[model samples]
Target: MMAPFSHTATGKKAAMALRSQLAQGAKFLLGLWMAGVIVAMFVIIPQYEGLGDAGRIIIMHVPTAWVTSLAFVVSGVFSALYLFRRRVSDDASAVAAAEVGFLFCILATATGAIFAQIVWGVFWNWDPRETSILVLLLIYAAYFALRSAIDDDNRKRRLGAVYNLFAAVTMPFLLFVAPRLADSSLHPNCAFIQGSQCDGITLELSGARIGLLGDSKLELKSLERQGDLVVADVNVTRPGYQVENHRPSFDLASGKPADRPEFDGEQFMLAVEQVDLATGTARLNIEAPGSGLLGNSRTLLTFFASMIGFTALFVWLYRLRAQLLMGEEWLAQRERTYGFPS
Candidate 1:
């Protein structure tokens, strides 16, 4: 009986040692993988057409933002689980995820500011997307503050779990829905993606068809095909600005806008989407800076790779933090029960 017990203990120790070795290997590989992703973000990706080298920040910025949302989702789920099962481990996990999420959120905001300064010539203009992210950071900050304020561990966990769930419920609206709902947002999705704020308006040259794009009135004056390119004469009128005849051009062969003329005294550009010379019709759009950046295959791939790396990093961080918290809780419980020094 003693020999069998000894063998069983030895086998368990061996298994534990193996798992530790495997975890260390995985962590080392993740570090190397993230290093490669950082290198690729700058060296492998091509310069964006409108944004140039400044577009590289999107590889980091978008991923951090995505990981922020994912972390919050994990926190909310664990918070709900703790409420249902009354498990201290679940509470620890929830706290760990929220802390990680908050860190990622700050990174996302910082990178976004850098991108904004390069593209929009300002660090922050309080755009809808920017404002929403700021709000999210504050909500999570309050979550941590609430946890620190409570003296009783049980009450803190219960109250924090409830607050975390509420905060998580608001995450989707603040990050995705609210920003898209704002028509005045200069976000990339508003300009490039279909069914957003700047979907481009169709106008006929002879029918006096005029449409409003943002605060500007646009009317197609003429459409002409010049060799391999199609050009459109658009009459643009802003409320406090002079009426200007903006000639935006498109490439017939490439099926893309060739010349995107900047709006007068503004960073926004006028993009000609389609021009039908035979029917005297044209589609005009207002493109914000950094619009259509992900259209490039290289940029898209690097961006996705960065996202995956950041998400994996978040998972590692969450696990480590949860274990640390659980350990502290165990030590505290032992001290309270048997007067053991914590």
Candidate 2:
């Protein structure tokens, strides 16, 4: 036999207390997240290939993307649980995750648009990735619309769970499969894609490159000697990162800094306090024009902090959403004692 309504309502209050206590950790995590965001934006290295400083936007953009994916997955899992158990609490959790996921999707879209404007010279180009994101946004909108249109709570929950499941089913296809199927896309080629040309580098935790002011941070891999001029094939890694290298005519025997040739092209002047050829590096007393806020060796710290901090933020947001859902269910149950309908 089903439990009495009064008894069930009391149980809901107990569950809410437990959830509220657990959610306190999420609040702490959110605090850490905001602080980390500030540091990522102002005190970290700009991660651009060519667009100079605007590359700092990736700190927000990439994290939002990751969080969006995570939210939807959580929603899907809870929706399945709700379907199996037919619990109001489980349904609320599914809804909470979906709503939070949608918000992150919006953040990801907005950040991507800003980054696109900086590099692609346009916003909303409807590239394969952009199209996929748009599709996901539309599906989420439809799901909410469906829920709002329904009058009965039981019907709404059942339909919403089904819709959430459908959305989850489409997610991997829209986010991953469809983008790859497209023959042409403005999106840069992945370095890890076997048998594909690598026009860009991967942003991963394991790999790193370091450099000082006005230094050859990385070699032009296709560089070749053409009798007189050393042909330097600089990869146009969009919004290029790190120091810009000029094709210098001088070589190792050209007396190093004393015989350094003039860079006729563009330059980011970091005041040369000293250039040590013996160590094959230079020390700058001034800042690199487009470098991010740390402006010194501290820029290295931004790299690890941003990745870890953003990930923590995503976890906190998902937890907070789950807690909010539990609170919502508890309030509804409490009101039912006064003949309030769910």
lDDT of each: 0.88, 0.61
**Model 1 stretches astray by more than 4 angstroms:** 1-19, 190-195, 206-208, 214-216, 238-242
What TM-score goes with each of the models? 0.90, 0.62
lDDT for each residue of candidate 1 in 1-342, tens digit (9 for 90 to 100):
699999999999999999999989989998998898889888998888878899888888888989999999999999999999999999999999999999999999999899888888888999999999999999999999999999999999999999999999999999888887865666676422353555688888778579987678998877778999988888899878889888999998999999999977777789898877787888899888878787878788877878888988999999999999999998998999999785
Question: On a 0 to 1 TM-score scale, where does candidate 2 land against the true structure?
Answer: 0.62
1-342 in candidate 2: lDDT tens per residue?
Answer: 456987899999999999988778767776876787677576556544345667566556666777788788989998999999998878888888888889989988998788677666788889888989999999999999999999888999999999999998998788767776754454532311321222222111122323221222433323334443333322222134544453332232342212222222323322222323333333222122222323234444553455566666666666667788688767776788767765
Clashes of each: 0, 9
Candidate 2 Cα misplacement greater than 4 A, ranges: 1-26, 46-49, 189-304, 340-342
Residue 112, candidate 1: how far off, in angstroms? 0.8
lDDT of 1: 0.88
C-alpha RMSD for every candidate: 2.6, 11.2
